[model samples]
Target: MPARPPERTAADLLTTFGAAPHQTPRQPPTSAKRGRVNRPTAPLRGHARPGHGWSPVLAPLPVYQASTREIGGLFPLLVASPMPAVGARIGYDVQSGGAFYCHPVEWVLRNGLATNPNIAMFGEPGRGKSSTVVAFALRMLNFGVRTLISGDVKGEYTPVVRALGATPIELGAGNHARVNALDLGPLTARWDTWTVRRQRDELSSVLGRWVQLLAALAESQRHPPSVSDEAALAAVLRRLVGASDGYTRLRPITIPDVHRELASPDPQLWRDLRYESRHDFLHQLRPMTDALANLISGALAGMFDAPTTVAIDWDAPVQSMDLSRLRSRGDTAVAVALTCLGAWSSLATGLRDDGDIRIVVRDECWRQLRLGPRAVAAIDAELRLSRLEKIIQILVLHKLSDLYSVGATGSQAVAIAKDLIALCSTRVLFGQSTRVADDLADALALTGPEHQRLTGPVNERRGRALWKTENHPAHLVQTVLSSFEKRLFDTNAQLRPTAGRGGGVGRSRG
Candidate 1:
């Protein structure tokens, strides 16, 4: 059926509601002139679109309630000034979207912000701490800065030293490389500038460093050095650098020579002590002699007993002593080697007046403090004098707690450790376990926000760390490395297990 010619549908009526009720097709607006299409136009101030013909509307716009989304908002409300561009490009600033540069010595010296140019780094194993140091050192070389690593506990820095065309002296039992404890090469220039009193004081200072090492050795063996032992050591050192014709005779001294002098004391020196005092002094000095012997002729023999096989060229951009072998021998051997290296490095830097920067890194710093308070004092003194020497010292370890672990909670050892940590003007900390974070928060004097950051998800970013400088807020930085650096500074290549030579691990393919 036609159904009354299909009554007008509701859809059809609704479709034409915006137009005339008669439902006639709307015609496009046209100009009064024939064949000319018309369009609405407005005055504009911006460049016009090429085709679409969109123009700015010059009309009074109505204002509406403003909201964050409507105002083009962002999430994190970060406000930080980028580190000045005065040093090596290490990474990017997370807060300010700027490049970050770092040079511990340069920054401190230039800004006069810190009295000590020493740096302290704490990170868990496998957190890229070593790599950051290696990269920083390599970059520093470009600026003519020289670096000396006093102790490479894991031999991790050998590749970097070699890559830079510098030789790494491997010191341990049976290694041909030997560093004469008294090689004057490091002290020659220093002695030249010294007056009689200064020379005596300098030599005495060296003797004191040696005594610290010996005492550390004794402490490790549960036999702390007695006062008599220390006095005897001072006396022996004075005699070793004895006077010749009213002038102090300076000669190349070996550890063996020092050992010999101790074993057979001068009759006049013995005459000064009472019978009981002499016996006690001898008894105390015996252990020191044994420590010297062990380092000179026992397990660590030949490493530092003779003249240095190869001179440490201060002109070289990088120098590192690979103490991995000695580290394997136990903490005692490492302590002794570290002591010698520290003394030598300090004297060497003192000898130079080039005004160029020098860096000394002591990885696994806790091992050196095991020798008790004397060693700690020696290191503290070195750190304090670093500014005058133009030397920047870096101490790298796992956690801040390591420093306090040397002695009882309230002992002088702990106090010295704390002082040593306090000397660092720049501090870098990687992600730590919750417990370590709590300990460090107190030790580092971290703010509430900093503590939360360290213990929160921000800490989960691998290779990312919080860097703090004097009177500055901590920065969360991710270290950047080039492909070459990634390979050159890899410390775990040897440690990682790989497939067998034939490719599979289960069985050998013969």
Candidate 2:
């Protein structure tokens, strides 16, 4: 029942116009008579001979990779629009024989951001995950694409980002440097500027309540006494905010008083108190906690006056979305700014024009995908349908286990790692010993040759990766930005020579 033209594919295109493929050629068929290739016979090739004549079923209209808007207006039919160029690569290392080697970080940037089909980067610490992100951000900046480099810690990339003339929007404070957080009222009034103002307010409140409760408990260094204690804590928060309003109606319960009244201890509730809550909360909290809140608020408020990117000037290179310096605040720092910035990037997709919008995420990405109440269906739906419509998600994470916390199944976090890898088109994995590298390779169903490239050689601080795609077979890549590369941009003002080509960092594994 499906219409003809038989769904043209990369293979079909290669066969048609002879797309040059990498690697050696396969043996030609014996019956296919060597040198000269046979051409299909056609009667009246130039002129109409039969009933259909020269119009002989040209081909069912294939969706020839045009913009959604362009396709609707028949741009593909005109054949005037050029295909997006894809040559950029992300590298990884893989093994071939007994010796270990490195490969180039490979990626073909075909403007995947405009449509769906996003990208992902998964690796472990010391694997150069953050370094890789920094290089990509630099590259995007070179392309004139504005970017936001956000993280819980102030970007170690600040020196380099600043060097690029990008503004550094540092959120949270570092050790010895305390930042006085803005209260909810001012924050709400401030944040009511973004397009998602109201919704963002609600989400932040949900996140803030949980975060504050945990903060209070952590402050007490003891278990919360009761639900009343939770209420009391809320009151204390209200009083501190100088609240004459109803929203800041939080009260405090003394820890010792509540602990004495405790009936049964809720271990899960206690644990949820702070080892962590939803990592996404960071985005919600950024406005309330950052010194940049008012600055960002003003920028957002001016948005109704101009373009979104221009309004916030948030995405530009000079505007480094910094989250470092908030050591004392703990996970809240990540929850407020870094996490929210990533979410905002995803939100910004489909809303931009002209330049490509690349959202670069680093550190514990697999862990971030881990969720509590959200639905996997929703996450997958967003990713497949609209998540990357206008923005490309450049996610870099640490471990395979971070993809899914032990029990959080059915949550939006489940199986998304797999979906991401499958649709990634480019999967550049770095150093992760254990079964993670092995399991990921197996999951992708990489061939023996592919496995060799992925598992070839890996180190703690730096390693290579191998990639697989629908069009291209498996290939290997190495971490492009090493620690030495990062130290070059460090503003600490200390200049040190990089480790020599022998690839030793202080001490190497014997």
Candidate 3:
């Protein structure tokens, strides 16, 4: 029904559709730039949505906690580094968020805080004492420090020694690994060759150590040797040592040689002695000879009665004399063997450079102290000389009480043990029983805080300990071991799963 539209021309279509005509141009409409939409002055108000879940809540103003730094701003003394940055790191000083270091040789030398280079560490079994020592020894080894562990009581250090590519000398009744007390393997580097005086002094020291060991053995037998007996023994020792000189001295002197001299005194020496004196001397010699025979030809033969089959590897990082086998041998036998090993280790170090750092670790040291006052004196002397000899002695024991327990309460032996404890300038105290802690506090003169810390709960304190050094504040340290160290230094591997025992002290859970 609509009327028909006419066909549009090309010009009309181009003009209407906004195309430029053939000769004329068409212009486009100009537009102003659109402005940004302004936000509403007032926020869209419905339920007033919160920026975060807590924002819209009409709660009391949040009570912000003050930081430790803020709190210490009011108490200046409360802010300071808990540990000095020196020596090898052994632990963490949580108080100052710093690494704790305890290399006695370096710390003391740098701080001028100690006169002796010995360190004493005590803890209950499984409290991480052995692990800590092993970690320390490993670190020290990196510094070219040689460690000589005299008594590996449970073979706790055997693995570490082996890990360091060292050979541990296992001593027992018939192990064939003997350590002759008289073999002066190497003299200190100071002496290019042994001078007569040096040789005499070395022999005298060996003789003195032997006398103390023998006296201790006799004391353990309930028949302490008399002064006269010691005098006679000393005479015999001097004669044998004097007769053997030059290349002949190379022959290792054994306990049997001294016994042989006593059994058959030179005719001239016998005639020189009074008749009653001679009789008493022979009587005293009987017990000495019997004890000597037990060591050489009796049950305890072949270990110490001959030359040492194993020589100390001066280049080895660690040399541990494994005494785990000595357990079956009675306490006296073990003590005697340890004494000989210690003597050998000492002399071996003396044969090296005085400036060279050497570590002598005495584990289960209470066993040696039990020998007698004379034995305690010998140890005391060793501790005193450690500084000059460049020997850092690490004495590991159960607790300070072990020292006093060596002899009768309040006896001279007890006094000597106390003296020995005093000589150690640095001490590491791990978790101990309340009774032991109390005793240590008194013996060490620990402050109230230190005493409390030492008596902390067993579960919370395994690897945590209080470290004290001469003229330095005691620091509460948490021993930190690397994952690798944990696997090598752990002593409780038998009880813990492989990965479970990877952390040394702090990582060990209750």
What would the TM-score be for candidate 1 when compared with the true structure? Answer: 0.78
Off by over 4 Å in 1: 1-82, 110-113, 189-194, 243-245, 273-284, 294-297, 495-510
RMSD of each: 10.8, 16.4, 19.3
Best by TM-score: 1
Predicted structure with the largest lDDT when compared to the true one: 1
Candidate 1 vs candidate 2: the lDDT winner is 1
Cα deviation in Å at residue 279, candidate 1? 4.7
Tell me which residue pairs clash in candidate 1: 216-371
Lowest-sum lDDT 10-residue window in model 2: 97-106
lDDT of 1 by residue, 1-510 (tens): 555676664334433443323333444434354453343344344346555344443222222233344223222454545456766777766556567778776667676655578888888888878888877788887788888988787787877777777788787755688777666665555666678887777676667776665566556556667787777666666566663324345667676887787777666666654424556546657887776666565556677668878666677788888887776677777776777777766766666768887888888777777666766776887898888788888888888877877789999878989988789988888888989989888888999988887787437766678888866788877778888888776665655556667432221111
For model 3, state the Cα shift of residue 409 in Å: 2.3
Candidate 3 pairs with clashing backbones: 186-351, 187-351, 188-350
Tens-digit lDDT string for candidate 2 (1-510): 866777774435444544332323344445344454443223455445454333333222223443345333433344321222232323333332222111111233343322233455666655666666666555555545455543435356666655655555554332221111221222334343445555445434533443333332222222322344444334334333333243333222222222222222234332334424333223323222232223223322221111122222544563444555444454433433333444343333323444454444444444334432122222333345333343344556565555555235564345654565554554556666657878766666767766655555544336455544444555454545546555544332233344566432322101
Give me the displacement of residue 141 in model 2, in angstroms.
3.2
lDDT of each: 0.71, 0.41, 0.70
Off by over 4 Å in 2: 1-117, 152-154, 174-311, 344-355, 370-388, 406-413, 458-463, 479-486, 489-510
